[model samples]
Target: MAEGKMLEEKLFSKHLNEEMEVIIYLPKQYSPLYKYPLFIIQDGKDYIRFGKLPKLVDELTGSAQIQKSIFAFLPYKTVEDRRKKYHPDGEQNEAYIRFLAHELVPFLENLIPSFQMAGSRFLMGDSLGASVSLKACLKYPYTFGNAVLHSPFVNDDLMELVKQANPGMLKIFHIIGDQETEVETTNHTIDNFLAPNEALHNLIQEKGFESEFHLFEGGHRWTYWQPFLKPSLKYMLPAHTFDLESMES
Candidate 1:
């Protein structure tokens, strides 16, 4: 199996007035000579551990199915912290979004001079994490052009933002499950995740964004979300120019 290293780093965010951890995945064959695309995944530890993302990225890149890129995983300190940062109306929402766009992006760029192209930046997350990813891309479309959302929590406010979004500025890959009828919220409330996701899908289609929306057969869990991860990555960040035959040799 192809292998990679996860380097853990800490960034003190002035916006949130706290220190946050960032886990970065550098592929085994990574070279400083080549410019790499950046994929920022929210819920850092869960994605690296539960989602088995490093292994998946190694396989995809090893097989030349997608580009060999840099993955930066961002984890919240706690469930309460995650709720505060990821939710649209949370007290720290605006600051967290700003931190991501202004603080985190520049940190990565300066850390690796080879990390090039602002357009190659992509943000991904699940549930409320996904909601925050969409919200960030919508607000700072120039910084994050591509986004992957898995069963995002949507509301009237999010829908309003989506309606006003300039589809030309962003490309999105979104998916939700048919079985997410009554998913539990952070506040212990039951929410029909499917209805809002379906509505969001229709809105994206109507707005003519460069996007793909899929309805799967599972619920809002990592097990269901992990299987689609490769496909979603390929869709949003295609490696059409990769020479598969040469790489396999």
Candidate 2:
């Protein structure tokens, strides 16, 4: 398979009042002449190091199993910072959501040749990162049309947001482990990720959004999430035939 390019960069977010680190992945067949879809991932470092996302994308896109796209991984500075931005009730949660929609999206679109339509943009994360991704999509469906959530940290506030959101405005790819009934949280507490995820799935279904929910066998760690990435990407970003000749005109 052809190799894709990875670049490390920093983005200054006015909302967070800080510079955030971003890892960008360009597909092996990437070209500035053709506009491609974009996937923005939370917990950027873990996704690269643990999830092996770049390699997965390389294999999938190289073999035409999924669409050739651009991936932007946003990594938080520290665990506390991650909690502040990713948790639903955290201090910077709202600001972080705004940064993703208002700042990050525009910055990437301007810097790279990407599809500007909402349908072409996607958000992905695991646990709290997944929660934040869902919130961002709920708040700004015009900017993000899809979310890939692996064992999202669901709470009442997030449930309410999903309840109030307009149906069909977004597409979601969600999965949680069947054995996630006793997962430990970052706040030193034990929570049942499975029950809440099931509730969230039912709500999403009732709300009429285009979504898929799965119950995997493992728990909440990357061991489970890493394997699901391929199917998530394939489901959310199906391969599309590009008319290069027409696009160049």
Candidate 3:
């Protein structure tokens, strides 16, 4: 049960005018000598616990296949708080975006001066959390260069934003389930995740983004997402020159 070490930090954000909790998982061999990529996960605790992220990171980095990146999770106070901060139309949506770009980034940079440039930063989330990550990256394209979205709760606004964004500036890894036709949203409403995800995939293709979109077998839950985690990491950020034949062997 090898895993990365988890550390917690509390930051008072002026943009949102509130305090937030951030959990960071450092790799087993974290050192100040080399810069590492930063992976920021929304719905932070879920990914750390349910996602089996630290173990996955330990395995992937141990295999010498993926980058030894830093994982940061940002959890909300409650379901209501998550809906407020993660939803596109939530009241704190704008401020939350500012918090990620203006506050969180700088804090991490100062806290661990070993992080690479802004391009090494990535944002990831599931469901509504995925939407927030995509929106935040879209809002600050220059700040966060990569996003990994898992069955995001999409709407007309997000589609339009993706349509208008420059594909060259951002890289995306998107996955949705074939049976995600009745996914539940932050508002406790049911919507078809597959259709919107397919539409988004098409738009990303038309936009010519360096992206990967997959239609997995299961619904919008950790069951499907956890398995794809390794593939997602390999696709988005390969640390070493991977050998396909060796992997197959």
Candidate 4:
């Protein structure tokens, strides 16, 4: 198995007025001489722990299935902080979005050798995390080119944002469980994530964005979401083709 180096870092955000913890993963063969794509995930700790992201990335990249890229996981300080940042109606939602685009992007780009272009950046999250990722991408289309949403918590406000966005600027990968009709939320309420996700899918299609939507046979949990990660990563960041014979010469 290819072993990637993981680093822990901190960034003080002016917009959120807090120090954010970031977990970064460098590919097994990572080199500063080559520029790489950046994959930023909201709810970063969960993805690292439950999603087994680094393992999957190592397997895919080692097998030449997907491109070797840098992954940045942004974890929240607390549950309340997560709600405040990821939820559209939450107090720090706007600031959090700005932090991702304006503060976080530049910080990472300067800290690491990367492609430094919109197309080389991707945003991903699950549930409310997915909500925030999509919002940041929509708000700053030129900063992120792709988004991977796994059963995002969508609402009227978010749908409206999608309606007004330029579809040509982004590519989206969305998946929602057919059984997510009554998922419990952080606010201690049962909500239907399926319908709103379906509506969002329709809106994205209607808006003519380059997207792929799927209704999987599962619920609002990582058990289902984890299986899709490989396919999604492969689709978004395919392995770079090289001519071995020419290089040998």
Clash count, predicted structure 2: 0
In model 2, the runs with Cα more than 4 Å from the true position are 241-249
lDDT, candidate 3, at 138: 92
TM-score of each: 0.94, 0.96, 0.93, 0.95
Name the 10 consecutive residues with the lowest summed lDDT in model 2: 240-249
lDDT of 4 by residue, 1-249 (tens): 228999999999999898998999999977776778899999898888889999999999889898878999998878898999999999999999999998999999888877777888999999999999999888999999899999999999999889999998999999999999999999999999999999999899888999988899999999999999988998898776332223221
Winner on TM-score (2 vs 4): 2
Candidate 3: worst-modelled 10 consecutive residues by lDDT: 240-249
> Clashes in model 1: which pairs?
none
Model 2: per-residue lDDT, tens digit, 1-249? 228998888888999999988889998867788888899999998998999999999999878888888999998788888999999999999999999988999988887887687788999999999999999999998999999998999999999999999887899999999999998888889999999999999999998999988899999889878989999998987876444324631
Model 3 pairs whose backbones collide = none
Ranking by TM-score: 2, 4, 1, 3
- For 25-85, candidate 1 gives per-residue lDDT tens digits of 8877766656677888899888878888899988888787888778999988889989999
The per-model lDDT (C-alpha) reads 0.86, 0.89, 0.86, 0.90
Give per-residue lDDT, candidate 4, residue 178.
96
Compose the digit string of candidate 3's lDDT tens values, residues 33-119: 556778889999898778888898899888887977788899989999998889899989889999999999888877763444556
In model 1, the worst 10-residue window by lDDT is 240-249
